[model samples]
Target: MPAVKVRKEEAERAKRLLKRLGLYDGRRRPKREGEWVLLPAVGGDAIGTLGYEVLPLELPLRPERQLYKNLESILAERLSEDELKHLRRYDVIGDVAVIQIPPELEHRVDDIVWGLRRVHPFLRVIARKGFHEGKFRIRDYSIIWGEERLNTVHRENGVEIAVDLSKAFFNPRMKGERYRLAQLVKDGERVLIPFAGVLPYALVIARYRRVKITAVELNRDAYELGLENVRRNERKLRGEIEFIHGDAFKVLPELPGHDRVISPTPRGVDALALTLPKAERWLHYYDFVHEDEIAAFRRRITEECRRLGRECEVRVKKVSDFKPHVFKVCADVKLG
Candidate 1:
């Protein structure tokens, strides 16, 4: 394997360029040696022309789950093209694999289970996922195979989080988004996070940045799990966390302003008017919006900022797809 050696500051830019030219190796994890980062790349004629030193070194492969299409590859021979199109992506939390079996593929549940088990040989449970229910947003899950429990210790972004699908909410797909936010956060900044389920965002940020984070959650189970998670990663974290079990609507009003306010707002709940006022510098507000309404969403946030008498700049980024033509977006609001 050929790897390029570039300064840490230029690593991201080089990786992007390599990816654009189809030379970056997505399967291998980059290794950092002090000021330089070793980026894995495919052997090519262009490798020597990239200016950076290219060395033949074996880099460690990323986790199998991050590859994302292994299960689909295993099932390609077992299922037809029409059935394959209905195959949705699944999440592997710790040792449990949770997937939604659509009506079209419900008859092939056994094959799906076999594929998942083959892909993740250490998997202890394979669950059929259901819609999120109640105010806590905990999903309804049925253990179709292996262990009869929904509890597992999920590891992501350098932290361990204990989650119980029957009790609380956790999304493993947000790992990259969480890391992006963590990198944006500065050391010593006072941060506030509302609807902090199991403290995923807080833990990841604190693991890298030395800051004081105050996270609030309304659900008792989530709050308890979040406290446990803090203890689980206390030694690894560089910052401090103060977890409060309370409703953000009532609690944030009594609290003082922070350098940054992150509202992982629940679906259908409008916390813009509630959270934007508490941010002294930056506000990362998450919401679901139709593609057509993204401009309207930006206007709404701008209007709220104006109403609050704060001069603001709002940049909306599509985080993920929620449904057809609908996306989960984050409005990064910077205030003066």
Candidate 2:
């Protein structure tokens, strides 16, 4: 076995070198033949996805132009461990760490999966999560993420939820609403939740008080997943929970009036301009769209209210800004 000797200076240089190459705290470093150390891949940031992201395999030598080419060969050669069709990489948290590969790379995810598990077989393979910004890392205490740990949780409010870190799926940042609903909901509020993904919000509300929840979801897969989650944790629920596989726009009119409704959606919210013109009920929107777009969206709601002759009370809350970019911002939105 050959020992890849590193002088004190060289090791320090390697740390900086790899850091620039998108390798961080948890990257495997070969000290000698067949011996590697998986360091702590961790960091912290107030705004961003899960704080820390894993550092996967790296090249033997720096081949910046040939990175993809090297990774391609590594995949075709079956260099990875367990097959994972869902794993992906990103430079979301760190600009240099971010790299975009085509969806076809899904076939190659196996290489990465196999590669990581061989070195750290016990770690859970959380797939398809995005990357960290410069200040953020998966190891960061505040971020609270890792494949080994489940992102979602059963809130004290009794809602069993799968945390959608991407915000494309769910935003855990909507912590304030938990308090708002607790105060507003009465003994038996008939509540409607459109586009319910896992019904995390509804579950929390149900835990706080007795309520009849009619949740509408559009995607078949998501709706089914939500049902399973609801069933698994039914004991935690205090009220009747119903799941409907229907489009909100198509079904909103058919359903009877309710005391309250929740519309928590859009990871990088654009605006509700499309729905504003026909807005009927008071709405709460919590998603990241453009700041400028909210006004136009409100106007649309005003027009819709006028036509229907309904009192449309609306509220928009900026849940959190997930990331900052040169021309755009990803944020959480709530419309009421």
Clash counts per candidate, in order, are: 0, 40
Which is the leading candidate under lDDT? 1
* RMSD value for candidate 2: 15.8
In angstroms, give how far residue 265 of model 1 lies from its true place.
0.4
TM-score per model over all chains = 0.82, 0.48
Model 1 clashing residue pairs (backbone): none
lDDT of 1 by residue, 235-281 (tens): 99999999999999999999999999999998989999999999999
Candidate 2 per-residue C-alpha lDDT over 170-258 given as tens digits, one digit per residue, 9 for 90 to 100: 43434456657656667677777776765667777776778888888776656766777678677876877888987777776677767
- Model 2 — TM-score against the truth? 0.48
Runs off by more than 4 Å, candidate 2: 1-123, 126-128, 131-158, 162-168, 175-179, 266-281, 322-336
TM-score (C-alpha) between model 1 and the true structure? 0.82
